[model samples]
Target: MNNVDLELDLNNLKMIFEDLHFNNEIQPEQIPNLDLYMDQVITLFESNLFETKRSVEDKLLTKTMINNYTKDKLLMAAKKKKYTRDHVILMIIIYNLKQSLAINDIKNVLKPIVEKIENNEKVDIDSLYNKYLLIKTNNSEEIKASAEQKLKEVKDEDGDVLLYILSIIDMANGYRKIAEKLIDKFFENTNEK
Candidate 1:
């Protein structure tokens, strides 16, 4: 793709970014106890993900995907063709995580928590999900602050949009470097076992 700068309004850009409010996530307590069937589960996904993006159809999830997740042991199997609240919670987490990580990697990341839940150990899945929600709520401000800091660090009176883009790229590269280190540490621990 060409890096030609467009005459974008910075205020509009800020507004666009600010407008990305997260509301699609349903709370753990709000999840219905009435176990949902396959079609109902699919409908839940469709109804819950994005209230906007009218032009975009989110049809990526299907029966096969749910089945595969269950078969792969990444999620607890549905009981009697109906998915429990726990099942729906896991499904939502898995689906969202799938956007950035591989299925196997997702399983690896969640293995400890899922195992605890499965073993009927002292694990509150809902509490864990709620904690995740809390963390997620705080992240938008953190991300915005980071982006602004990156912009300031790269600011140049003579620099155009390319400079800001480069700044973001630098930040992304830094994140990648640290993420790589974390992954290395993760595997190092696993390798010891």
Candidate 2:
């Protein structure tokens, strides 16, 4: 009963990728300021992020993963075995990034933001996360329109699934790469000041 009955094809993937937006990400302010234990953090992800899950086995997060993220410095250390809103926001970014990029890549990409936090600067995780969300959300419309236009451009009305699928992938990569470039540019501007 838990199995998904959806079929995969270019049209389907196009719609899927188009529908994939990060607006559902947990806002920092939504998390409580009080420190929460590991179990609480898992519960938070499970309940709040469950909508992002494609299946029951697709767990949003786990203790070992959290521990590993902390150990790897991809995440800040939990406070007395508890997590704060900052921790949650960072974890959210990690969760999303890990879907496509490798752990090392994710660590490197987020290093600047994490370092700013470590320096005790008034870095706004909320604003940062919001920016990421904005980038992803804003791209959704462009992705949808681009996919639709490209699909229409195909000579075969029945469609060549392989070609369409590859096009979708290219479009997806284009957006993610652009997001990375934007992030890099933001950090560069910050560094210059």
Query: Each model's RMSD to truth, in Å?
Result: 3.7, 6.3
Model 2 — TM-score against the truth?
0.75
Q: Which ten residues in a row have the lowest lDDT in candidate 2?
A: 1-10
Model 1: weakest 10-residue lDDT segment is: 184-193
Evaluate all candidate structures by whole-model CA lDDT and list the values in order. Answer: 0.69, 0.74
- The parts of candidate 2 lying over 4 Å away from their true place are 1-22, 155-158, 174-193
Pairs of colliding residues, candidate 1: none
On residues 50-131, what C-alpha lDDT tens digit does candidate 1 reach at each position?
5533346656468999999877777777789998888888888887677556566666666666676678787667777888
Query: Any idea what lDDT model 1 has?
Result: 0.69
The candidate that achieves the highest TM-score relative to the unseen native structure:
1
Residue 73 CA displacement from its true place in model 2, Å = 0.9
Candidate 2, 127-172: lDDT as tens digits: 8777887887787677667777776664244446466667778877
TM-score of each: 0.77, 0.75
TM-score for model 1? 0.77
